[model samples]
Target: MIPLQRPPLPEELVERMSARGERLPQYRGGARELWRDSRTIRRELSAHLVAMAAGLSRCMYCGDSEGTSIDHFQPIAMAPQRAFDWLNHLWACAYCNSNQKRDLYPMDRDGLALLIDPTADEPADHLDLVLATGAYRPRTAKGSETIRIFGLDRPVLERGRAQAYVRCRSMLRDLARLAEHAERAEAGAVAHALTVQPFADVLYEMLRLRTAPRAALVFGAETVAGLNMLKDPRALRGPLHN
Candidate 1:
């Protein structure tokens, strides 16, 4: 999963939430079964959740890039308090978020969240996508439970992930080779280019698995590793001439 940048909320929007929080009755549900309430906080949050889901147009659960919907990674039945928790709300695709991740938040707190929080942290920090198996590994235990809860490996999701994984790894490999053989300036130039404009955007796509376009993972890891190494070539090369 790629790291996500949380968009800032406008002042007016924040005020609306604040007013609602202060005036509304306590949310009577948990994360699992809040959607059924049509007259309470659950109902109100459901509208926002649906709005967020509609806004994404892309699935938050599997990054399918199609058939997006508001997905509750944790069943609405189990954790009702999170019914309106903004963080708990995710825009998902019909397949991954709906069919696979039906109320499955590993009851064990051996880890944190099962689904990716496009707001809290970067997915790439803990998870790595394997192209062949369409699975992810938390480079940590916390990530493992997160993966299990969200069902990141549904057949459709896996295919999308695998496609992207292969593509990204391939790009990184090419960049790495250039870094090793190209002149210092040339290497730096390429690295800098990747960090900005198309390069950085492309990397972000690899980093954010929940939204990456399907069939884009035909790349490899060498280039990605190379870019990581090229971080400030002068700092790296300065030590070599001595």
Candidate 2:
């Protein structure tokens, strides 16, 4: 998972959400009912979430399947007060929301949640991506819990990430070549391609490790050169860096 920035909601939308949250306790039908009742607000929220999501509205947790649900980061069952809070909502795929994560939320003794909030925390700070095998190596307790809760190392996801790593390397090489020829249009197209694919963490990890010791050995000299080419402002732009 990469760090996600939550965009500011309009005052009107924020007020709507706050009002709904305030009335959450009065809803005899509970959070689910109230959530379903706000179809218009939900639709608008979903649109903004998709706009902020990586690569064709991919799940914020897994970054694999298309995000089809608006999940409460802090489960409504556990934190009813945050039921309508925008900060507690996350764009997620059906599998991650219903199967993997569900309502299981683990917290530390200090009352801090163990689950990594992609919008609030940088995932790389807690979890390390093993590029060679496409598995997550936890660097902290939070990372371990996040991986287990989200099933980040599941076989399908691992396979996809492994494949993505190879594809990203090839794309980077193409991007470097295009940039060398001052083909701004082609380079921009390549940059766009790099950001739009699934398993975006693969590309992110590659870029992160570009300056690590023996990075050339890990990503190969040519791929490392390509990764370095990203420093050129004219070579890449837009969501690739964001």
Residue 167 local lDDT, model 2: 91
Q: TM-score for all predictions? A: 0.52, 0.94
* Tens-digit per-residue lDDT, 1-242, candidate 2: 99888999999999998888888888999987898899989999999899888888999999999999899999988988887888998999999999999998999999899999989999999999987789999999999999999999899999889889889889887877887788868888888877788988888888888899999887787788777766556445543463
Q: Which stretches of candidate 2 lie over 4 Å from their true place?
A: 236-239
lDDT of 1 by residue, 1-242 (tens): 44433444456655554554443345454323234433454444444544443123445444545434455545556654444445656655566665566766664465555445654666666676564666666766546766776666456666655565455465456666766675556555544444432112234544444233443344334544554554434523432110
lDDT score at residue 195, model 1, on the 0-100 scale? 40
Count backbone overlaps in model 1.
43
Model 1 residue 132 CA deviation (Å) reads 5.4
**Each model's backbone clash number:** 43, 0
